[model samples]
Target: LTCERYPVRRLPFSVVSEEDLASFERIVPGRVVTDPEELEASNVDWLRTMRGCSKVLLKPRTTEEVSCILRYCHGRNLAVNPQGGNTGLVGGSVPVFDEVILSTALMNQVISFHSVSGTLVCQAGCVLEELSRYVEERGFVVPLDLGAKGSCHIGGNLATNAGGLRLLRYGSLRGTVLGLEAVLADGTVLNCLTSLRKDNTGYDLKQLFIGSEGTLGVITAVSILCPPKPGAVNVAFLGCPGFAEVLQTFSACKGMLGEILSAFEFMDAECMRLVQHHLLLACPVQESPFYVLVETSGSRAEHDAEKLGGFLDQALGSGLVTDGTLATDQRKVKMLWALRERITEALSRDGHVYKYDVSLPLDRLYDLVTDLRARLRPPAKHVVGYGHLGDGNLHLNVTAEAFSAPLLGDLEPYVYEWTAGQRGSVSAEHGVGFRKRGALGYSKPPEALQLMQQLKTLLDPKGILNPYKTLPVQA
Candidate 1:
């Protein structure tokens, strides 16, 4: 396999032989998948842009099984790719080479839940939406949400330290994730899955795996803090004259709603047009240069509604907003959110997508997008900007009739250079997977990169766990 040439520094290495296959079957039995047809789905990413050359896919149901497999693979100096829902944007969830594919799909199980404390513990492969449903039934929320909720797994979210729509209110996973249980590359299970809110221990070791992108270990289970579901929810879709008004409206809403404000998302006219044209979703507001989707959740419906209404009225009267629509019913609220959440899906349907999840100063975000759009106007079919505005993260995507070298070249260093110039992050939410490894230099210092390499060397040593990912090649 091509992965074998990647130079994993360890011992007992060789191609998979009959003896290895027999040993693997002894552990997983029927779950050891070698059929090309079955392995086909596991080798490709969600975007169908990258493909791996793996010949075997192993689905382990328990942490013990995973540990056992890793022990054997580590002993034999074999590379392993840990996969969750395969919905990662940065090609982190899929294999980069022909390493063994270790999928957590069959490990889905809810271990425990504390109603009073609002904490839930579950296996790594449980779907995000399923976890949300389980907790929502008890008047609690998962404290995290994303467009890929239906397919993305909690372990995957933790692996990437996923920040989603509710981040403005609930904060990042770094705060909400209480503890984690991970299986290290050497088959050692680091069990720290506690539900305690505060623990000022020496190292906070579990954090190493949170955004490590499976390089350090495979996340087996997670214990996360859930928030109580608000009794009242209000959503408003507002049209703005330009990006400046979007920022102004955000500041105004933040002051007006305070704690009740949960989300402040922004989308440009180009994105709305794509969503309407591709997804067939009708735009709720008049066509404008920009749109802001503001949501507030609180225990008191009357108070929350009054706050939202007052803010909208003031913004409109002050010319901060041009037109708006308020969604009071649950169905209407969902419909409004769909327009923002479904932008990714709509863009996928358009053409070959080059996605960038970057962070820039809130004031310079509009200028960045405008500058990039002007630069790529001819080579790129469409360039759209939208994302969690309140968090300063922008999902800048460019679509082309087909993937071309010129189109990609024009977007790189230029976009990354611009972000770096503004002291912004090249990757705000998405981890540095195979796709963004080369761009790490733009965001990380040389010393930091050296330390990351040293850590990867110490953890895996053999470079078996998700090789060629997160950290770039050290000179």
Candidate 2:
């Protein structure tokens, strides 16, 4: 939440004048909120790691209103921060300074849903969990499911290119989002809201704004392809003696379960201990160095159970797994899945948490956590490792008495250097917000970085959109 230490200098942009406030009022009069109390929440991030001092917040209910606000802001050189759910981990959602907040809270509405093709088009501010429930009633499933589903807006998920629990099977938003409608910097509405699965007419322009993190434009609507809800689902929690056994178990599950494998997640004993101590959630299986949670969904319950049972038997028989528990009922399935999803909630109660969601080579995934635990045992409260093992994404977190400078100094260039040595990405699911913006060079080449800068310039010429985030500071 400290902004004084952050290195980025504020751009020389026009402040929101009385005239500017009046113009925003013209768009949505009652929704223009400038009260200090209400503005405090949107000014800070979900993790409470960053804060902004924006004086005005505008809530636009329709795409045309959003376009009008952006176009006017563009002409006046007034910086705007487009916000959806504001549940982002990195400092991407909150503003760094006094930029006018352009919120999509009032824009929540389901536009059209074709049950036959399983395509749903809705306003960008729709809450992800609400959409899931709405589609579930119609026998369709939203492709992306995350821990923040209850609060995270679908547009915010698309903005950050969120890769949640379902990515192992449903894939990324870049593939699931078929078309979108965005308001450019000049208020130009680029509507590519196509429902067709195959549209090769011209260049796919909507993909640019999908993961751009509100830098290029304000996404007002999204057209995503929703998959049908699977008839049968099962979850299994297993204990492994070591990381090697976890790997072997993963291989066996993939080879045997094949198509129905929904998610494959792993966590170390440290994570479980913290969850039990802080959150009072007991582990299903006995204590082990490692644990795995496997989920399978199919059309037939009996067939899925037989396949999962066979995989469990092979894993137990081959010594890949030491102990396990299975759940087929909905309530039990949710109870088991909560152990993996609630790691974030549990960490919040401990103390200030330093999180690094990185994508590393499978072999070197846990090495960073091990090295940190050995190096800084006294100063560091706990070094926990747990994440989506199926996609080689490691959620490495270090809890401490407070945010210590020495701990960060030892971890930073050290972790980035280690991941870079293995040709890994510094960020996996969490985008490079202000927290990790400087580390982009480690994962990107000079040529690629230049091209990204070029795109930013071409789209948002004035850089009035969410600044001091996404791309690294200009050299």
Each model's lDDT comes to 0.90, 0.90
Residue 406's lDDT in candidate 2? 85
Q: State model 2's lDDT.
A: 0.90
* Alpha-carbon shift of residue 234 in model 2 (angstroms): 0.1
Q: Report the lDDT tens digits of candidate 1 across residue range 1-475.
A: 3443233333234567678888999999889899999888888888777777788899999999999999999998888999999999898877666678999999899999999999999999999999999999999999999999999999999999899999999999999999999999999999999999999988998889999999999999999999999999999999999898899999999899999999999999999999999999999998999999999999999899999999999998999999999987999999999999999999998888989989999999878889987777665888899999999999999998777778888988788999999989999998888888888999999999999999988988887899878988555
Model 2 residue runs over 4 Å out of place are none
For candidate 2, the C-alpha RMSD (Å) to the true structure equals: 1.3
Off by over 4 Å in 1: 1-13
Q: How many angstroms is residue 20 displaced in model 2 relative to the true structure, after the best TM-score fit? A: 1.4
Please list the Cα RMSD from the true structure of every candidate, rounded to 1 decimal place.
2.2, 1.3
Compute the lDDT of residue 254 as modeled in candidate 2: 93
* C-alpha RMSD between model 1 and the true structure: 2.2
Against the hidden reference, what TM-scores do the models get? Answer: 0.97, 0.98
